[model samples]
Target chain A: MNLLSIVLYPLISSLLIRMWGGKNPKLAGWLGCVSIVLSFVVTVKVGLHFFINSSLEPISHNLLTWAILPSHAILFSLKMDVLSFVMSLLITGVGLLIHIYSLGYMKKKEYGRYFSYLNLFIALMLLLVLSDQLLMMFIGWEGVGFCSFLLIGFHFESHKNMNAAKKAFVVNRIGDLGIFLAMMIILAVLVQEKQLWSLAFEDIRTHLDLFLTKSIFGMSLATVLCLLLFIGVCGKSAQLPLYIWLPDAMAGPTPVSALIHAASMVTAGIYLMCRLSFLFDVSHFASEVVMWVGIITALFGSTVAIFQRDIKKVLAFSTVSQLGYMTLACGVGAYAVAMFHVVVHGAFKALLFLCAGAVIKASQGNQDVYQMGGLYKDLPWTHAMFWVGALSLSGFFPFAGFFSKDLILSHVHEHHLFVFVLAMIGVLLTSFYIFRLLYLVFYSGKKRDLPGYITPWVMKAPMIVLAFLAIALGFLWTPSFLGSIDLFPQWMSSLYMIPFSTHSLWFEIGLSLLALLFSAVGLIAARKLFVHGPIADQWIKEKFPKLYQLLLHQYYIEEFYYKTFVHDGPPSNRKLSQDTAFTNSLFHFISVIKGMFDRYVIDGLVHWFAWIPQFLGSIYARIQDGQIQTYIRWITMASLIVLFYWFLWVSGMIA
Target chain B: MNQLFCLESYLVISSFLFVIGLIIVLTKNNAIQIIIGIELIFNAAALNFVAFSYFRPHVTEGMQLSGQIFAIFVIVIAAADACAALAIILSLFRVFKTTRIQNINRLRG
Candidate 1:
């Protein structure tokens, strides 16, 4: 099957599900599930074909031209390189699992709508990955955003869910503006200098030298465009300042959290950076900004996750933290490493979310970790799956996160030690929060004698598959000391090479050991804090009240935003009682001017403009008075006058 | 034919017919009288064409009967126009109960 068909298959299924899905939701869900699985099957074939034939350049199939311009045009095409193939596999493969899991998770709800949204998300994500041109990708980009909004607000009956959906969409829209500006700048620069106005990934790479040479405001055009694109990345991938929306996005269903937010959609920003790696490669300043923003976001999210008691919110923040690591990878010019982490993170994080969904289902919608206890005995399969996911997430040995994340750390360590130190701290917090969540939910306190809820095999099946992937996919790429086999990275190296740490093998091994040691410390810390009766928690609350409160309140970021955006004016809130009469009058004068302009200048122009035709039409209305004799008399008089003039002229008397 | 009537005489007859029709139509208020006036105008136009053709037999390159054909087409079109106009007048008169154009001014705008 063609690569385009893989995207179309799920879209066709989504439409079908919506049409015939009202009365029989079970069938609709299955239909949606089967379509994604079929796409995944085809993706597997395509991926294998690409990997087996190493000589093939990125195969592009131009479906049609999207727009024809005087200078250049963009094609509605699909490209299946190793990078896209990997992303496509992750999307469709993990998407299928999430679908099967949703069959159980959303069993009693509007299965038709849920499954249809899920199917559409997969289709759009595939479109995003497979698109050859950035313009074409934008369609899928906005499409996935819309689906994210729809799914986030799926339970629209509640005000909180609706608010969360709106926040996610509005924040993403702000980032989308940045993307649009970046695209315009790139196109404009290329057209001006190189006479090339194309949006294809290949074209951009080819003309990147020209783009780098062009200067805008004393900054390279490449730097400005890259920074603008990074803003879009911050929005989609949940980096600092724009990271607030992802936590609130936990209002969505768990499968949506797993598939769209965690596995695929959030990774779109990373994919974009990787696709435009050539641009970043030439812009050191922009890459530094990307690296710093990423590490800060990593620290920020993981810190907030430590205090979040809600299970999904913790996972949501952890997803943010992990995405920060990927962005950091991109920042360091480790494009292949970033993509490697994307694939590995897709597996385990999705696994973690699905397991959390099961736990939430078992707990009867109780999302707070403190509310539940001792589920390790009752739900063994879920506990086992959640353990695998947690281990992988914490970068434990032999799991997917370890290899990919260690790769990122080694690269960072080679470049900047301080940023590497910050990233290590982020890793420590990641493991601590993940383990804190694990121990608090599964191993702490006495077992509650609750009624047994049978989690259907459908949900368990996907978790089992994802757990296996979380454990095994790491072997695809490993460091030098562990019988180094760089399979995945080597396959994707044709797009952009991931700069391996030039440090010695022993140093690389030492870095891996440090990662392991930190994860171990985090695990032990979580154990001491959360395993027994809340002794450490109480001691911390009592001894360091302000710090505890600060962590608990998320450093009051939301309150700060609300105060600035919704409550008081910016200057007044910044300095209390700073609003003087002068400022007030200034504001008042502006408002008065605006009001006058709106009422008089704008409306008066419109009214007079309208009155012009009416005034002229009144004068012209006399000709058609519906009086036959009057019109005939006028015509006769005019004709007689004309004839009199003509006779005199012909007699040569008017000269 | 040229001995019996000259082009100038024919032009005077047609012009008189046209002026009389225009005067009668402008003065009258009845719908039937207006229709009679319009028929007179049509006949004046057709007579002008036939008279020109009769006086100047071969004015164009091998197109001797062009004016007569045009007059025939004018006559045919006038007959159709008269039938449709009379039918419309019948409907208007039934609705307003008047044959006078001034009273039957439903289509004023």
Candidate 2:
């Protein structure tokens, strides 16, 4: 029941609030929070049960089955396993916090609409995590994308927000196409060749040999599926080429930035890859692409993060970078580690964003970090919460980010050295930029006499809770030297086919120490550069003008995309015009026929029918002169005519 | 009634009355005259119905008197209709200020 409600209750709340809560914004907001809280409680209950009963098998709750063929069936179901349990707990728990935060974050205009979208997002996110079948998961997946589109464009009054939402949706659709195509190919293969059709994860995993044997244009079908699925991952997780939308998604409200962009929805791609770990494990080429994509995106996101001016954009890029780390863990076959990072990162990233919200709120809607400085004393609680969140994000010791990141790093190091080196670069840049954002926003420069905007308790409560989580949640799985509890990874071992290989305590400790040192270095460097104002900023901008400009402008990838696709491909390609002309003329011909049919055939028939009624009405209307004498004369004439006809018939003069 | 007066006499009188009423209705310019002409035609039809009921053999099954009942219903309906027609004429006079039928052509389509 609890498991069912985890997906059901929020959907119910969304509908109810949409129906009845529009008149009362406070009631709507509270209703949104209450629904998520209920789901959160259910998730916690289910998660605890799952943890306590370690030997328990994955429980599949089949809701309905649509039988398409005698041999095939598609089941709409929800599965409760160690993996979904962890993800659900994160989604609901952090989702509730974000909902509470949104109460304070949203403005007074159409806030019920905002709460509706928020609740809808939670429901979809839960559905995505708890879904049993791949098809069902895709439904949840597309649903989350749709809700994100709605929430990101919540302030649809602004063109910028609407465009950002459009970009995010369009990019995700491209990713979804990959999932769709992969599903199609898999289904086609299962139905046509293997003669066994099901999309349940168990069925797919069991039929690996059949999938491996099948070849698509000379490449193994499994490899193609994995690669295509990775393409989907790239889009959702904000990896290379598709990472453009996440930064601009900051045009939405801040709590939305925290929940969908940073914490839960963006990690869906990583979750998908982890869910399909067995398939990915079999495809070496696909794994390599995933690794490289993760590394490049991590580097790209962080480098861009370093140059970002807007407070939310900085966090947005940092989120893109952090998602890259989780994706990297998946690529390196550390599925459990990737999931662990997903959970820990969900806590801290949400904390960071909520604190940023407080800052944005206190600063009177100013989002530029440079315009905001010395806010530490003005917003003491927010400052402290931001500190915890930032430290955790930077992989500072004892915070949640440190443990999971350390685990990922150790695994990466054991598997590949060059990949590990690139990952290290990404880590350093992540730390430097986040601390730089912190230093610029909170600690550095002269303090402005900001208006006395009190941070609401609704906002502060979530930050406090997330801050606590950021500080202590890492203890769930500490390294061996730190007493080696390792509860989270151990708990997740059952979900993945290949368990994480345990490393020596010395190696783990060494990696943890190194991560701590790098974090400290990044923090100290950020302090030196930003704390004293414009010296390093000016120096770097002048010294590496081209590099600075490239990073600042996100390497002109958006412009390149516009130039290539939006502006009719390249000028050098003359064939493009010919192709377009052919298609255009074809469409024009069809449209001409359609117009003719509409104007002459269809409309002519209607007009002809209308003319009949009009003609008859005119003749009848002439007799209805409304004169009593004329009406009486006509009645008498009609009576006489009838009498004459009757007389003739009586005399047998007419037949 | 048939012994006292031949059926032809009643038929002739009613036909003459109907013709006179028709001529009056066709020629009348006043709305009230047109209504009176219509009532004269209605009375002629009522008289014919009574004459037919008396002359015919089995129209009224002993005490049923269906034709007489029908004539009484028609008379009652004509009285109500006359009252309604007079009310309409009064309203028409209020709007147009004259009861001349030829002039009251406001409803001409």
> What does the lDDT read for residue A13 in candidate 2?
89
Candidate 2 lDDT tens digits, A1-655: 5677888889998998898788888788878888888888877777676657766477667777878865577778888888888888888888888888887888865678888888888899889989877888999899999998998898898887898899899999899899999998888877786676677778788888877887777888889999889888888889897887888789888999999998899999999998899999988888888888888888888999898889999899898888888888888888988888999999999999999999998888899887889998899999899889989998988888999888889889988999998888878888899989888988888788898888989899999999999988899988888887877777777767665657877777778888888889899999989995546766889999998889987897865654444435333344544454544555667778999999999999999999999999999886776765667678878988999999999999998
List the candidates' TM-scores in order.
0.79, 0.75
Question: In candidate 1, which residue pairs clash?
Answer: none
Sum up the clashes in candidate 2.
0
Chain B alone vs. reference chain B, TM-score for every model: 0.87, 0.89
What docking grade does candidate 2 earn? medium
What is candidate 2's CA lDDT for residue A536? 71
Give the DockQ (2 decimals) of all models.
Answer: 0.43, 0.49
TM-score computed on alpha carbons, candidate 1:
0.79
